[model samples]
Target: MTLKIDCQLRDLDFTEVGTHAQKMEEMGFDAAWTFEAGQDAFTPLTLAAAATKNIHLGTNIAVAFGRSPFAMAQQAWDIQKLSRGRMHLGLGTQVRAHIERRFSMPFDHPARRISDYVRCMKAIFDNFQNGTKPDYKGEFYQFTLNNPLFSPGAIDHPDIPVYLAGVNPRMCRAAGEVADGFHAHPIHNMSYLKEVVLPAIDEGAKTRGKSVKDLHVQTMVLIAAGETQAEIDKAVEDVRMQISFYGSTPNYRGVLEHMGYGDLGKELSQMMRSGQMAEMPKKIPDAIVEQVAVIGKLSEVGPKVRERYEGVLDRVAYYYPIPKDAEIGNWKAFTDAVKHTA
Candidate 1:
């Protein structure tokens, strides 16, 4: 399958979101996504939906535990209507600490909770679209109350695609069983995807009488590509730091362990405990960086990514920082190359 290139809109200025999305559409991107970092994920997509006509809009992830299913379904339904049926609502079960301490929400049984969460959202969507009674009672959530006044009514495009973001086996399985697509973490190599992620998702898919091929597998790739060696080196260093940061999390230690870096994962966790965040990147070696990120010249990146993930992934986006205005042409070249490659 030919891999489609997706774009993540990171422009912080709300006023510039529509224009940025328009530029991505003109560049021939398949989707424009936003993450729940410092701002609301759904809000920007609403802007993008209004500003652009063809490009798909989605949340790279909105915290599923942070909002009720009703609230999330409401936003998704409105966007699907406004975008004329081009909204993919991606949800994530953020780390326990963030879900509990940061969002002041409960985080018990995250895997099951997220699975039930997706079902609940779908139930709500069904009720709105087909006038089906909202009577879904899952382990973590229940949706039995939906008055006609509370409903957003029916829309022409009510079949919104839902994607789940995960790294561990259980969550990957949950995505397979429940979601329309699975979002792979950037802190991963092909080995982990083949040995861990794909098998886990397949296992879950079997429970639902489906298979891995039934779901879309999208990943965020850390690409260290640049016009010059110096720029490439800087990008590689940035990717190394990102890998270290993500590998420190216990939930993601499996990826490191599978990559023969279990001890490094432990040390990174120790550094996090000791508040040595600034020194953690130095511990990641160049070899690890090369394995985790695609390193090459600007012209070589597209083909290298295709060679690495041609059949395994349906869509991919760069995990690096959004390119500056001057750097947009280079990114456009990468996207064009990805589309035209044999």
Candidate 2:
């Protein structure tokens, strides 16, 4: 399969999204994604839809429990119409603490919850498009009422694609069972993808009489790329920090343990609890850094990433902290290199 390059809109300002998305489309990006961090993920896509015609718009992940499935379907439905069926709805069940403490929402049985969530959304969309009865009853979410007065009737594009984000096996399997695609976490290595993620997804796919080939697989890759040696070193340092941060999270411990970094993961979590953030990155060995990230100069990054993930991923985007401006102007060279190389 030909690997497609994807990009992210990191700027919180919604005003600049249209122009940035326009540039991404012009530069030949297959899609642009937004994540739920400090701002709403849907608004930017709405703007991007009006600005670009062919480029796909999606949420890298919008928190699933943060809103009702019906509400999310409505937003995605509108964007699908605005973009003429180019919207992809990506959803994730955030960790328990965040869902309970932060969002103040229930977060039990995440794997099952998300599975039902996707089903509910599909049923709601079916009702909107085909006037199919919105009778979906699942373990977590149940939606049987859809008054026509509240429904956003049929449109040219009603079959919106749903992608689910996950790291653990259960969640990965759930995604394969229902979602149109799976979004791999950025803090992943090829070993974890091959040994754990793919197998679990395939297992879940089997339950549905499907396989990995039936779904789109995509991920956010950690890349340490720069034009100069000093710049490359700086990027590596940044990547190290990211790896350390992810390693400290309990949810991501499986990837570390699978890579023979179980002890390192425990140490990082301890350091995090001790408020020793400055010391965590220094503890990540060069071996772990190389395994988790693609390190090279700007010119070499495109080919190296393509070579590393060509058969493993159907699509990928470079993962990093988005600068304040978050314009695609600086990334044109990198984007061009990937397309030309492909």
CA lDDT of every candidate: 0.87, 0.87
Question: What is candidate 2's lDDT per residue for 71-166, written digit by digit as tens?
Answer: 999999999999999999999998999999998999998998899999998999999999998788988888899888999999998878899999
Q: Worst 10-residue stretch by lDDT in candidate 1? A: 320-329
Instruction: Give candidate 1's whole-model lDDT.
Output: 0.87
lDDT of 1 by residue, 1-342 (tens): 778888787755889888888888877778878899989998889988999999898888999999999999999999999999999989999988898899999999999999999999999999998889879999989999888899999999878989999999999999999999999998888999998998999899999999989998988889988889999999888888898898788888888888888889889999999999999999998877888899989778888887788888888887664554735666677777877642
TM-score of each: 0.97, 0.95
Model 1 segments more than 4 A misplaced: 327-329
Winning model by TM-score? 1
